[model samples]
Target: MSAFSRFTPLVSVLPSTVPFVGPEAIERQRGLKVEARIGANENGFGPAPSVLAAMREQAGDIWKYNDPENFDLREALAAHLGVTAANIAIGGGIDELLGQIVRMVIEPKMPVVTSLGGYPTFNFHVAGFGGRLVTVPYVNDREDLSGLLDAVKRESAPLVYFANPDNPMGSWWDADRIVAFARALPETCLLVLDEAYSETGPAGSLPPIEALIGLPNVVRTRTFSKAYGLAGARVGYAISTPGTALAFDKIRNHFGMNRLATAAALAALKDQAYLAEVVGNIHAARERIASIARANQLSPLPSATNFVAIDAGRDGTHARSIVDGLMQHGVFIRMPGVAPLNRCVRVSVGPERDMARFEEALPEVLRLLD
Candidate 1:
């Protein structure tokens, strides 16, 4: 295939790929339908009725661009988090915010630190910007704070990402430990403390807004996509010192936000009761997933987030077979990409119907594999 001749050296050298394959793409490529959409860590309980109503109410205003500054959302988030408006930066989602963060601090070949099998999207952004990745392996299925710190110091890395209630494994460290790790870091090394699963994590898993808010080197990212059930809305925010928060305004696409999505997020925030209810449902579904895994002789790891990672009690190849087998039954699921962590298959919490699909399919898949 022919392509444009005038491209940057980096762009020409980089392979064209996304971090993860979407289920739609899987369906298209494999001629299979995803009946149980429990692969992506999406809140299958869905947004509240009030959120839908708000989006419908805003439908007439879709023709107009969203407020470029995102003033209202930031103010609302600030009030909710007990911070000033200047301390918040709103973006399409945490993914976009991660890219912007990498672009801001990482020059060509600059070292960035993260867990070995951490969030791949962040690694995708780092690679896109020509940043070198310095990885620290997981300790006992959780991100290694000490290992990450050591790598950062040894490499003199400029940026480090640590996701609480982490993805893939759903493990987490306590708030105090996380805060201590943040304080121990060199002020020159910025920390992207990703709390995307904050709403769904255990009580003590997330540090208070006041704990790291004063640190210019710390940027904590959160999203309405999990317990709030607004993954499609693409609403996420970053909390930091006023000076650090303002940097996002320099590079972020000001009008990229969808008007209805913003309306959905605003309404989701207002409905605290609905958020609590959905979180309960998530917890219950997590238990149900664990039960299903255990009944089939698989071990389900304890999760602080909305998904459970079931150890297939074998190597990565065995876990891959389980993931592929489940998909054959119209159940879509995912697993970690590297060794040891990849020994488990990840299943997201969903409504009862989706859960039933997973339950009915898992045992049969395991039986066939046996």
Candidate 2:
């Protein structure tokens, strides 16, 4: 195939491949359907009825572009979060915002720090911006905050990514410890404290808004995709000092937000009752997944997120086989990508129907493996 040859050296050097192989792609490649659909860490309980109604009502307004400044959504998010409007930077999702942050600070070959098996999307963004990744391995299935800080200092890294109630492992440190870790880092390093699973975490697991509110170096990325059930809507934001928040405006897509998605987000925020209801459902589903893991004679790692990581009593190969076998029964799920952590498969909480599919299929998968 012939192609244009005017691309930058960095762009030409990089592989034009996506990091995630979504279930849709899996189904196409393997000729299998994803019946359970409990993968991707998405809230399978679905969005609120009120949100659906709002989207339906606003469907006619799709002809208009969303406010370039995102005025209404910003005001509502600020009001809900008890922060000034100037402190927030809205984006398509945490993923896009991660790219913007990387673009802001990372020049070619600059070092960025994160857990070895942390969120791959952030690392993808870092690589896109020509940043060198310096990873600290997980300590007992959790991102090591102290180790991350050490790497930042030792490498004089300018950017670090930390996910609360982290992905893949679904582990978290308490608010105080997280705050201490943030404070210990040098002011030169900016911490992207990702709280994509904050709503699913236990009380006190997340730091208060006031804890790191004043730190210019700390930008916390949050998503409505978790407990809010709005992953398809692609609503996410970051909170930081006004100056730091304004940095996003320089490079972010000014009119990229979808019209109906904004209406859905506004409606979702107005319905705290519904959010509380979904959060309860999430907790129950988490317990159900853990119970299923236990009944299969596997160890279910405690998690503050909407997913549970089960120890398969073996290695990554065993974990991978269990994951593949589950998919044979239309149970789509995922596991970590590295050793030690990859010894476990991750399952997201979903409605009873999905849970039932997993519960029925898990034993058969394990029995086959055994």
Candidate 3:
């Protein structure tokens, strides 16, 4: 039997791939249950009691489709940030929103700028849309704002993507520096400021909502998937000018928002006390991770996000060994995918028991490598 042959040329030309090989797939492939799930940057701390309650109550209503407009969640987010509801657009997650943003602006062969080793999901979206990605290498383990700006100008790129409290390396820039970089970009360029790790970052690290709220060219994407402990809920939002946000409606799935996920997010927002408590726990877990790395004689990079990127003192192969070796013991962790950055393995902050498992597994994994 042969497959249908009427697919678009771009679709036909693209190779099939999964950017992330999830733990579930690993379990299926290796026949090993994931005893400690501390790899996916998921909040191992779990969601708030309030969010759980809300989801449970809404479970009965799952038979109905979610509101196409996502009015309630957007209003709740607006009140939380003191922005108007029109400025918000909801999506399945940052990953889904990324595709929408690319579709809204990218044409085949148009330029899109990003850090070389930045989030891969964004790059995947660019590829799907046939956008030419112009990448700038990270400098000293941080995304080079100057280099990104240069590429944007050089490529005359219509869109650029950046993440604060970045993934893979868990490095970040202070708000003032980030604001300066955003302000310097040309008004014609659209900036996708991914702040998925915002809840775990320090106070001065995030600029005030009002800081970039006025810029028509800037759209900040945030997720409840981080400190809110809601990754499975698939809830995220974009903050932009009302005009800029309306563009999402043009290409978004009218019923994409899950009713329960919106309910979970609304309840999550109301539980600020829970958020503050989780942030504290995240900080403590980060310290615990750092201490464990020190005891193992490896260096753990400081992280504002929910994960630590530990320098394994070697190249990508060595880092891959540590990663694969951990999975052997049912401890699933990840590492950066590119060179230089791949020298570090990223372990997400999790419950004390999971961390204890990681602590127990590290020495044996390194010993086996020796």
lDDT leader: 1
Candidate 3 Cα outliers beyond 4 Å, as residue runs:
none
**Candidates sorted on lDDT, descending:** 1, 3, 2
**Tens-digit per-residue lDDT, 129-206, candidate 1:** 999999999989999999999999999999999999899899999999999999999999999999999988888999
What is the C-alpha lDDT profile of model 2 across 173-243, one tens digit per residue?
A: 99999999999999999999999999989888999998998999999999888888999999999999999
Q: How far is candidate 3 from the true structure (C-alpha RMSD, Å)?
A: 0.8
Residue 353 of model 3, lDDT score? 95
For all predicted structures, in order, the TM-scores are 0.99, 0.99, 0.99
lDDT of 1 at 317: 94
In Å, residue 134's CA in model 1 sits off its true spot by 0.6
lDDT of 1 at 225: 88
Judging by lDDT, tell me the better candidate of 2 and 3.
Answer: 3
The per-model lDDT (C-alpha) reads: 0.94, 0.93, 0.94
Q: 77-146 in candidate 3: lDDT tens per residue?
A: 9999999999999999999999999999999999999998889999999999899989999998999999
Clashing pairs in 1: none
Error of 1 at 77 (Å): 0.3
